[model samples]
Target chain A: MNKRKVYIFLGFSFAYLAGMFSSDIKSYFIKEVYSTEYGNLVFKCDQAMREHFIAKQVVAAKPNAEHASSLMQAEIALIDCQDYDLARKKLLSFGLNEYDLIELSLRAIEEKSEDIRKVVEIHEIRYD
Target chain B: MKFDTIKPFLCALAVWFVFAYTYEAAYAGLRDNTLIDAGKHFIYSTSLTPIDPNIKKASLGSKLFEDVRLSFNGKMSCALCHIDKFGSSDGLRNSIGIGGEGEGSERLDSDGLVVPRNSLPLWGRGESDFQTFFWDGKVEKEGGKVRSQFGDYAPSNDPLTVAIHLPFVEIREMVNDDYEVKSSLKTESVKSAEKIYDRLLERVKENQEYVSAFDELYFLKLDEIEFIHIADAIKVFIQSKFRLQKTRFEKYVKQESVLSPDEVAGGLIFFGKGKCVSCHSGRHFTDFKYHSIPFVQAGFGKNGFGVDYGRFNVTHDPDDLYKFRTPPLTNVEKTAPYGHSGSALTMEEAVIYHFDPLRLISTENMTPLERSEFYKKLLASSEDSELIPYLDDDEVDTLILFLKTLSYEESSE
Candidate 1:
């Protein structure tokens, strides 16, 4: 009813809308304009989600899926066989570049030792 | 007085139009993006999208699923272990497939060959994203690459198709553990698997019913047919029959249904204070990753003396010692006798084991050998178990109520 109150209401509405859109604008700008190839792959994977089934069917150590595990197995095998060339071949065959094996989680035994459940909890705590 | 009354009517009309315009605009905006965005999230969270089952393929698979010819012994069927009435699992701590008779616990009376591991339920096994199979996770997908016992000689690219190749030839599963069966089928080596596959193929081809079904599905001659064809059909059947159903929780999430206050409270604790969402994430309530929660070992155990190395036996890596997959929680209430060995008798017992495995295990019950083995398991899993917080009586009850919300009746005929 009064001009002052109406002005105050308008200002609060503007602030509320701004606060909401600020997150959207930042995400849009980073993902669409800047992050490019990296941000392009947000959800195009099952990744390690299906990496936990046991098979007594047959034993094949093909470099498939779960790059970390495959590469780790290959690395351990490489240490024994000392066959870098074969390891390199297996890497390419499994659709992994040799450089991908260099990831610290794959290299450092204990670095990736944090339990998966704990990691998820830590993520929520840090971000949520 | 007439002017005042007319003015009030005009003001009311203006207010009505303004409210109508604003409501329409807001709804339009929601429809264009917000609604779709929310819907996408709901689908992702529940993954309850029903997949259509191919009638002919599934029928063929259903027949083969109950076929004794799939086994070398000509006695056991896949149904012996994976009975549909038992939530696609035999309600036994250990399955008695090869020399076993009767159903459920009745099989325990037979001098049947006992399988080492508990029969895993076939709930969402053939879902497009369900790439893991077995208690040990021997067949699994990593970075889009599927790995199994087949090594470099994997039969199919899809893990489910490859995974289906196991049960028929596995000792005490479908294949009887005998010198004759072993020598005839070469059941140990992968080639023996192929040998048995050819025999099963011939049996199917000889049948007019199966031959016609295969011909209808693939437009193939008997000569052109392969075991992978059989595997794929069975996979399609599993995808159709055990397909994901929309749970009450999914409906509640979509704002299409209501939940009791207890379920809501349970859900809050599940994702919030309980930390269940850490491993039991997504629509399946599993991340499909492995963990060592220190459940008591039961049955003969994978390694004997009530010991199973679990994932460590699969890879032989010290890091993977005592780990098992975080099982999906669909119809978890029905698929009882939990753990890889069916050690926990109830869901409450299973949940309690995660935080306090020793509480359930009495030192008096275990043998001297079992005691040492359990200590080793406890030592290995103690650190991993500590990562999760303890759930008290009320919290565990609410969690079980929330779990009940995940149970649903399949509409499949």
Candidate 2:
């Protein structure tokens, strides 16, 4: 081939190679960072923070016996640290796996936690 | 004139004719009377009964609506879930009841009982021809006979009055679901509800303000005050406060106001191609019928395990599975997070869910069980959803604009 023809052919080959391995080439240059440590810490912190907050709110609000019992049940479900056998049975009955149970429990806890915070706020307002 | 000489002028005239015809055809819904005529067939003026509520009774009812003393827990009231800021809704996905504290999102922070259903707004409720109540139509009137959980011993023949009787006796609403309440009250029986009413009446009678007001309004002595009287007073207050006010759409229909081009286009889509008029027909913008739209179920459902049977819970019919009453659209703009589960956060999403529910679903995030539940809902969806013609993004936006026209004037409210 002539010099111009050789250059043109080389350009096309280079373009084809780039197109073929673009994603892999990009991945080599740009690495995705994922910190399992940070994720695990966040998860643990959230669980602990919620539990402590719920405990403090319950004490401060001085909710009635019935409300206290109900709160206890919700807090138990929310924390998900204990009562594995109960959780497993409930999940089985609902035809759900552990992940689904965790999701549902967290959602229920979020709602309950919201309510607990409101009660504490009300108590503060009334006393203050 | 030579053929070449006349050709340019003839061509120009032809172009002008085509342009005019295209423009007219594109805007025919606005320029002509056909769209308005078609809209008239579906919509009518809100037929509100003129109510002159007795000052004393309505005042008492207003007080009672806010009074926590009516609840067994002394923490909940009708005002807690039905606030003015949310246009009579609590601004939560599911209403926090009995053990809940504060108002709106503030209630979410408390350990309050989650009601598992979105709070229905009070606008245009108990108005003329508005017969159904609740998302499941649990309290309804058919063939002039009021039907409710009360069965044969319905407290009042009036549907709204019977509906008013519910929250006061409902578990997790006003009454605590403790062993004492459950054992003493039998919770589900008519006798138990009657007993609870008597207890509430006694509490109301203890307050001198309520007693005097009841005496003035009903000519009943403090001892003679019944639970029915309380319901009637609250009904009067609701009727007076939340009655349907005239909307921009009403004014447009009455020839008092002119809608913008976008609004007109939206109105055309809503009544014509959107097929929204099928379920959202009549004066109050509801046929008061049940429909299943297959919206994403959020939180633990009414039947538990993230599955709500909706109207099937009431009728126990297989056809009624996943069906819910068509909610009245009055003040709909203010009541955000729509649907029976309050899953759709905006008006656009709610409207989109009606025809394109799967478009909003994230299949990657869903578990096997959730996917199975969604499949069941998809199967149970109404055939009416199929009737809606495909709308482009602009058409959907315009349709939302038309919905805004249905909003009552801020000053009027």
**Highest DockQ scorer:** 1
- The sequence of per-residue lDDT tens digits that candidate 1 reaches over residues B212-328 is 888899898889999999888898888978877777776766667766656765665465345466567666778788788777777777787667889998899998888888888
Against the true structure, whose TM-score is highest? 2
Off by over 4 Å in 2: A1-128, B1-32, B45-49
Q: What share of the true interface contacts does each candidate keep?
A: 0.00, 0.00
- Model 1, position B79: C-alpha lDDT score: 78
Error of 2 at B348 (Å): 0.9
Candidate 2 per-residue lDDT over residues B157-265, each given as its tens digit: 9999999999999887788888889678864789988888888888898999888888788899977989999899888888878888888987887778888877876
- Runs off by more than 4 Å, candidate 1: A1-128, B1-50, B183-187, B410-413
Candidate 1 on A1-128: residue-level lDDT in tens?
89999999999999999997875565445333322222111111111111211111112433443333223222221211222333434344544443443331132322333676745553455633
